[model samples]
Target chain A: MRGITITLASLLILTLISVVFANYAHGYMVFGILILAALKFIGISFCFMELKKAHSFWKVGLLLFLVLFMISVLFLAK
Target chain B: MESKILNHKNIYYPPGGILIWIIIFLELITFGIALIVMVFYGQKELEIFHTSRLQLNTTIGTINTLFLITSGYFMARSVSYLRKGQKEKSSLFLKLTMLGGLFFLGLKTIEYYFKIEAGLTVGHNTFFTFYWMLTLFHVIHVIVGLVILTSVLVGLRKNPSKVAIEDVEASAAFWHMCDLIWLLLFPVIYLLF
Candidate 1:
């Protein structure tokens, strides 16, 4: 429960940061938003999806997937 | 032998089982490709995409994200309570999760209505095309997820002890997939371009 609460709070804060600083971030806005999103994605996967209790294989696989996804998005956006 | 099988399952299968995870990965890949393609097109049709994207209601998008994330938190709580043998608490959390989903659908419907009224249909432009296609597909997933959750809730109410944790986890996994997809979709569509 505490874990989820903290995860939720972190996600909300990240979201607000993405929204609030979007204009100020200028050219780097997309990168910042995607980074925040990647963090939220990890939080949900580990806490809400209970990947923390799962085997190392699944955890590592998901992290790899996220990294690949981020690289692709950032590359394409650039 | 049974203990060995259980141990193997624990190591290989996640909370929802390997099958659901496979489906989740496939879905994520599909959406990922679509998003990348959308971004590629956005780069080419920068003007059309930017102007059309501004038609979107960022406030509504942000609210829906909150709804889905809170719903996901409720679903995680539901599964946690069920594991602790607290059926009532679990059921309550399940209902709250469903409520959050309903709120999302409601807001999305309103947003869609306004878009259609403003002639921002799928045929409107390249951006609207991707917007309608990706978001509508996601809406379908959320609807299916709600149905799965409803079934799990029914099972819990009918025979609490008989309700399997694996089943609940499977449903929760599906629900979180919706949240995950939206997490990717919202920023790209509404904020990025």
Candidate 2:
């Protein structure tokens, strides 16, 4: 419960930080944001959802899917 | 063969809820792809993206995030309650989750109206296009989640026993994933625009 609250707090702070200077951030900063986003998702999946209990095949499948999808999106991106 | 359930001392094998997990995973993959494409295409218009960020109301975004987080907490609690055979508490939480979904959609609609009035249409530019598309895509998922949650709630009320509690948990997990994605997106689009 406490952890969930903390996550929510951090999310708010991040949103505020972005709103404060939403326009000036460059690719480097965007990359940092992406990392933060990925980390948050990982926390929820592994910590909260207990992905460890899930089958190894499904876990691998998810990782592979993300990788491939991201690559495709970047490949076709403007 | 007697009843196979996860009680105080009896745990079932090969839980029948695995299929739902696969569905959630697939949906996440689709959303992730869309996110990457939007960011990639809109990279050149980072300036407009930043300027437009000011137009969005961060407070609303924060509120929605908190609402979803609370829902996630309730979802986790409801699962625990289910394991303990506390049906009423579990159903209540499920209903609460649905309410959170509705609240988010309402705020999103208001946000959209504000954006349209501010001359931030999807076709305005690459940045605005991605902004509207990505957020709306997310909104669609939220709607889907709300529908699934409503079904679960209705089932819980009519015949709680027939409804697969684990399946409910799985749906809630996907809903949280959607929430987490927006937690990242709201800041990236609105704050840093």
**Highest lDDT model number:** 1
TM-score of 1: 0.95
Taking all chains together, each candidate's TM-score versus the true structure is 0.95, 0.76
**lDDT per residue as tens, model 1, B95-163:** 999999999999999999999999899999999999999999999999999999999989888877677
Residue lDDT tens for model 2, B79-107: 66676778899888777877888888899
Off by over 4 Å in 1: B1-10
**DockQ of all predictions against the true structure, Cα-based:** 0.65, 0.26
Looking at model 1, residue A59 earns an lDDT score of 85
10 residues in a row with least lDDT, candidate 1 chain B: B1-10
- Identify the candidate with maximal DockQ: 1
Q: Kindly report the docking quality category of candidate 1.
A: medium
